[model samples]
Target: MQNQLIAFEGFDRVLNYGLDRLRCPSPVGVDRRIRLTQKVASIEHINATMFRVVLDSAIWIEDEDKPAIIASLIAQLHAAPDTT
Candidate 1:
């Protein structure tokens, strides 16, 4: 993965984005959003099945919204083939 600095809610961390999925810095404390999507079954079924979008834990920490953006990007990439 590349060392790409992505800004979160108020923090910054290196986020790695791949063709199929994204690896986001894990959320700290009693987190719920990013932490909950650790499971394949936890993400939206469409994204999981079609785009194979995934969210996994990492050594870094950041805001939860970053993953949502990643997922959107992945879906757009996945859909690009038929659109253009």
Candidate 2:
């Protein structure tokens, strides 16, 4: 995963992007918005039913809107076409 510092939620957050599905730990914590389909590199695999998206625990503890984030994630995952 490549780490890049991006401004989010009025703070500089270290956002990791690449093929890795795991969210990298950042000092400022991760925002749930960054975990969307565009940012998640393994999204195609997940959408194809080849695997699943794993979220780091920090998101649960840090993101203020975890429930909605989780819900959106789940909906996106389930909305994918079943390849298996």
Q: Give each model a TM-score.
A: 0.19, 0.18
Local accuracy of candidate 1 as per-residue lDDT tens digits, 1-84? 312322123222223334344444433455543322232323333442133334442333355444332332221113322333
Q: lDDT of each model, Cα atoms only?
A: 0.33, 0.31
Of candidate 2, the 10-residue stretch with the lowest lDDT total is: 67-76
> Which lDDT value does model 1 have at 55?
42
Tell me how candidate 2 scores on lDDT: 0.31
Q: Which candidate ranks first by lDDT, i.e. highest? A: 1
What's the CA RMSD for each of the models? 13.3, 14.2
